[model samples]
Target: MGAAAYALWGSFPLYFSALAPAGSVEVLVHRVLWSLLLCAVLLAALRGLGDLRALLADRTRTGWLGLAAVTIAANWGVYIYGVQSGNVIEASLGYFVNPLVTVLLGVLLLRERLRPAQWAAVGVGVVAVGVITVDYGRVPWIALVLALTFGSYGLAKNRVGRGTPALVSLTGETLLLAPFALAALVVLEVAGEGTFTSAGPVHTALLVSTGVATTVPLLLFGAAARRVPLTTIGLLQYLTPVLQLLCGVLLLGEEMPPTRWVGFALVWLALVVLTTDTLRAARRRAALARSAVASAHG
Candidate 1:
């Protein structure tokens, strides 16, 4: 399920690509509004309305959840903008570096100790970022922003616990942003600035599909995250960024310089180290459990 969700998410570039002229901001607005409506209906259908009420009653938790939702929305908006505007390679860089960002966060925020190999991987990432900066003649801000925002979003989510059902919680989040989305739609329409009307049928369908496009995979992802082990999901996360990178280079005709290549290489190295560590830990735990069971049997 995680793989499927990530696959769908990875393929989002195709959907957003067709919506040119509608612009990223416009599409983001629609995504927020439509996603709210869709998730709300689904929640009601699933008899999850009680969960929404429960979430609302806990104002403190709801406030924190709202912050998380907003953070994630910012991450989504930036990512969509990057993809639609032919910056997909940069966007993919974000996800590639995400694991490293999480590691940094752990070190700084959680006071976790890293092994020497982990520190070496982080150093490699720093060098890669320097290479990318030199190649671009500017900091890789978009990629960094995507990474930081998303990393923070994940951290915030951990704090929130199971405050509400996914649908219910996300519904509240969407509704929080709906008014802004509605205003943006109105402003864009009034200014005759939207890409919807001029782009014809295909673009229009894709634009509207952003809502389903956004929500469906998330639902699938939420389901998948629960069913799959963290290690499996951790490995599968790469699929989305890989697809995005391909779309940027092949489909969008974006050029990747040698320095950018080095950056990506370093990021991938960090992920390999992290994922390898996680899998080994899981294996060690399993082996220990087996040994204990064998001793008991003996």
Candidate 2:
């Protein structure tokens, strides 16, 4: 299930690319409104309407979900633009950088302390960004924006707390954003710029299917989370970016000059360091728990 979720996520470039002539903004608006519609239907089908109502009744959680909506919308918009503009490789780098960005957010927002290994990993990530920036002859703003918005989205979700079901939280977030998305779509249609009606039946269907495409992987990931360890999920998370990178290079035929290769190598090195530290930490915690249990039994 985890692999399927990431695999779907990684293949998004191909999906978004197929939505051409629609533009990123139009696609994003459709994604938001249609996703909301799908979430509503799923909530009704799964008997989760009560959960959604309870989530909406809470002001604090609602505010966090609203923020999550904004950040994730931004992430989706930037990602769409990147893929449509033939920057799939750069966009893939964003997900590669996202874990590090989350760690940085923890330090800055939550006042968490990082171990030495984590600090080293972050340092390597910074250098990697610098190398990639130089190679691109400008800041990889698309990648940076994608990483930051997603990191912020994660922070908002953390605030909403894990006790909330993923579907319920997504419904709340999309519900908050749906009005704005609807208004934007109306404006686009009025301006005769919307593709939903003008585009052929195939294109129209693909646009609508965006909702299903967005929701399915999320549901799969949620299901996987219920039955997997965090460490396992963490390892599985990399599959998405790795597949995306392959899609960009092999399928899209994006160029990766030597400098860009070096930058990506550094990023992978940092991920290795971070992953090793994470695994070691988890093992240590497990050992300590076992020791405590043994002591109690003895």
Candidate 3:
């Protein structure tokens, strides 16, 4: 399920790329509006309207949801911009570094312990960032911004707990942000800068589908989350970047310099280390469980 979810998410670049001539900001607004509409329908169909009402009733919790909403919307906007502007490869780099950022967040914010291998992976990621900086002759701030913002958004969503279905939470989250998005759409329309009204058939269709394309994977991800462990989810996250990288290099015809390739290689190596460590940990736990069962039988 996680694999399917990530696969869908991995292919998102192609969908968003079709919205040519539409600015990322306009595209993002359409995404929020359409996603909210779709999510509301799903919530109603699933009989989850009561959950959304309850979420709104609690002003305090709703405030936190609002924060999560804003953060995630920002993350989405930045991502769309990255993909639309020939920076899809750099955007892919953000997700590539996200697990390392999550580890750092745990260490700094949650006081979690890290194994030596984890530290080594972090070290390698640092070198990759340095390589990218030198290659660009300046910091790739957009990539870093996307990584840190999305990474932080993930942490916020983690704190949101899991009482409601993902569809409901997503509906509530988007509804919270919809007013702002609507206002922006109105403003852009007034200013003659809106894409929804002016963009041609292909671009307009692509913009509208952003809602479905974005929400479905998230819903799938949420479903998978209910059934999978955090480590498994962590492993699945790489599929998104891998797909985006392929889209950027193959479909978009973006040129990757040797140094950028080297950076990607280092990041990939770090991910391999991290994945190996998690798999080893899972195996050890499985072996211990089997031993316990054998002892009980004896």
Candidate 4:
């Protein structure tokens, strides 16, 4: 499920490019509105509306949901813009950096402690960013924005992940944002700039299907989270960025300077270190658990 979810997300550039006639904001608005409607229908079918209501009734959880909505919307908008602007490589770079960003956020905001190897990984990530910035002779704002927004979004999701059923949380996010999206669509229509009105049946169908594209991966990810350990999930997160990077370079014909590749290499090194540390920790824990059980039997 995790692989499937990340793989779907990695292929997003191809999907978003079809919505080219529309602005990123327009595409995002449609995504929010259609996704909300889809989620609402699913919740009703599954009789999960009560769960959604319960979340809204809880003020703190609701606040986190709102934050998650804003961050994810921002992430979506930026990614679409990146694809449209032929900055898909930069977008891929952002996702590549996200795991380190997420880990740093945990250490800083959640007061979690990192082992030596994890800290080394974080340091390598920082160096990669520096290298990329130097190569550009300016900060890669596209990458930075995508990484920061998504890292924060991930943090927000973590806060409510265990308690909220994935479907309910998804519904809440869409429901919270749907009004604004609908309003945006109306304004665009009034200004005679809406794609929905001007697009052909094929294009319109693609636009409408955005909801399915958005929801399916999330549902898969939710399922994967339940069955997999965090360490394994963490490693799987790399697949999306790697696929996006390939698509950007090979299919999209995006430019990658040798310097940029160097930066990517460093980030890849960091991920290797981090993954090794996580796997070692998991193995140690499993061994200890087995030992404890053996001692108890004795």
Candidate 5:
């Protein structure tokens, strides 16, 4: 399930590519509409309406989701634009950097502590960014924007409490955004610029399919995270960026300079360090738990 989730996300360039003639904004609006409908059905089937209602009723919690919706939508828009503009490599860089961004947000916003190794990993990530910047002669703003927005989304979800059901929260998020989304769609239709109207049957279907493409992986990733350990899920999360990087390089034939490769290598090295730290932490906890039980028996 985790692999499936990452794979779907990694191959998003293909899906988004098929949604041609519609600007990223139009496609994103359609995604919100369709994903809401699908999530609404799933919420109903799972009897999650009560959860949804409670989330909506709690002003504080609802505020977090509202905040998250902004970041998620921004992340989606930037990502779609990146893919459409032949910047998939830069887009992949965003996901590759996202885990580090999340950790940084934890430290900065949540007042959390990090291990020395984790700190080293972050330092390396910064160096990687420097290397890439020097190579490109400009800051990779698209990747940075994507990472920051998604990281903010993660922080907002964390603030909302982990107990919130994924489908329920997402459905409610769509509900919150639905008014603006519907308004945009209506405006586009009136102007005859909407993809659903101008893009023809196949493209229209592809645009609609973005909803399922967006939601299913999220549902699967949530389920997998629940059933799996953080260490395992952390490792699995790398698959998305790895696959995306491949798509950008191999499938799209994007030019990758030697310096760009070096930067990516440094980033990958940082991830390896972080993943090792997570595994070590998890194993240490497990061993301590076992020793406690043994001591009790002894």
Candidate 6:
């Protein structure tokens, strides 16, 4: 399930690319509106409407979800633009950098202390960004925006606290954005720029599929989370970006100049360091638990 989720996420470049002549904003608006409709239907079928209502009643949680909606919307918009503009490799870099960005957010916002290995990993990530920036001859703003917005979205979701069903939370977020999305669609249509009516039925179907494309992976990941260890999920997270990178370079035929290669190599090195530390930490905790159990038995 985890692999399937990541694979679907990684293949998004191909999906978004196929939406050409629609432009990023139009695609994003359709994604938001259709995803909301789908979420509403799923919630009703699952009898989760009560959960959604309860979530909306909480002012604090609703505010956090609102922020989450904004950040994730930005992430989706920037990602669509990147894929549509043939910057798939750079967009892939964003996800590759996201875990590190999350860690950085923890240190800065939560005042969490990082272990030595984590510090080293973050340092390497910074240098990797610098190298990539130089290679691009400008700040890789698309990558940075994607990473920061996604990191912010995660933080906002964390503030909303757990125990909220993923579907419920998503419904709330999309509900918050639905009005704006609807208005945008209307404006686009008034300007004769909307593709929904003008685009052929195949294009319309593909556009509508954006909702399923967005929701299915989340459902898969949610299911996988209940059955897998956090460490396993952490490891699985890399699969999405790795597949995306492959799609960009192999399928899209994007050039990876030597300097860009070196930058990505550094990012990979940092991920290796971070993953090793995570595995070691998980093992230590397991060993401690085993020792405690043994003592209790004795």
Top candidate by lDDT: 6
**Runs off by more than 4 Å, candidate 4:** none
Q: With candidate 6 superimposed using the best TM-score fit, by how many Å does residue 164's alpha carbon deviate from the native?
A: 1.1
Clashing pairs in 5: none
lDDT digits (tens) for residues 17-75 of candidate 5? 77888999898899999999999999999899999998889999989999999899899
lDDT of candidate 2 over 5-116, digit per residue (tens)? 9999999999999998899999999998888899999999999999999888889988898999999999999999999999999999999999999999999999999999
lDDT of 1 by residue, 140-168 (tens): 88899899989987876666665345677
Weakest 10 consecutive residues of candidate 4 by summed lDDT: 154-163
Q: What is the C-alpha RMSD of each candidate to the true structure, in Å?
A: 2.1, 0.7, 2.2, 1.5, 1.3, 0.9
Model 3 regions more than 4 Å off? 227-230, 285-298
Q: Among these predicted structures, which one has the highest TM-score?
A: 2
Q: Rate the local accuracy (lDDT) of all candidates.
A: 0.83, 0.94, 0.85, 0.90, 0.91, 0.95
Candidate 4 per-residue lDDT, tens place, 172-208, comes to 9988898989898899999989888587888898889
Model 5, which residues run further than 4 Å from truth? none
Off by over 4 Å in 2: none
lDDT at 159 for candidate 4? 79
Give the higher-lDDT candidate: 3 or 6. Answer: 6
Clashing pairs in 2: none
Q: Per-residue alpha-carbon lDDT of model 6 for 176-261, expressed as tens digits?
A: 99999999999999999999879799999999999999999999999999999999999999999999999999999999999999
Which candidate would rank higher by lDDT, 3 or 4?
4
| Residue pairs of candidate 1 with colliding backbone atoms | none
